[model samples]
Target: MTDSLDPVVAKFVDALNSGDRQAFYALLTDDATMSDDGNDRDLRQWTESEVFGSDGRMDVESVSDGGRSLVANYTNSRWGSMRTAWRFTVSGDRISRFETGQA
Candidate 1:
């Protein structure tokens, strides 16, 4: 993660790269929500399957919106690699929602 990345978003990426499930979940709000490819998803279940279970990681290529939005080369055991975009909404010190999809 770069210095330009939002602290919350950077921590999320770090947790993902390190496979720290606890740390990752700790960054989210109790009712955190998410979307994938424009479809709403259950955050915890999606994280269990597509993130932790799939061994996902994001190599951020660029950041925008004060690091609230980014584009990256995201990869996972299940999907290999793809150019992806991520957008986040922060509430207090945690992420309240996020949206991700192919870029």
Candidate 2:
């Protein structure tokens, strides 16, 4: 069956696509963490400031959730197209922790 996290994942993707930094940040916990492949950096707080910045564009291709995880298909001018997964640890309707990886 489809997981319940699908809508949340979709909203996250939509925020990215619309360049809504506030909306994107609102979906994450203050201490939430995100990592990519073997990159030894935490992409939580700086994602909006550094990655999206003020002009980056994102196009969401799809979204899927597997209860505890969320995968998003998207394309961007800076990062190109990729299918990435964000594993989430939810706490009281907020994502307390998250990790990103190729899907």
Per-model root-mean-square deviation over C-alphas: 0.9, 3.8
Over 4 Å off in model 2, which ranges?
A: 1-7, 38-40, 44-46, 49-51, 54-66
The 0-to-1 C-alpha lDDT of every candidate, in the order given, reads 0.92, 0.60
Per-candidate TM-scores read: 0.96, 0.64
Compute the lDDT for candidate 2. 0.60
Strongest candidate by TM-score = 1
**Error in Å for residue 39 of model 2:** 3.6
Least accurate 10 contiguous residues by lDDT in model 1? 1-10
Cα deviation of 47, candidate 1, in Å: 0.9
Q: List the residue pairs that clash in candidate 1.
A: none
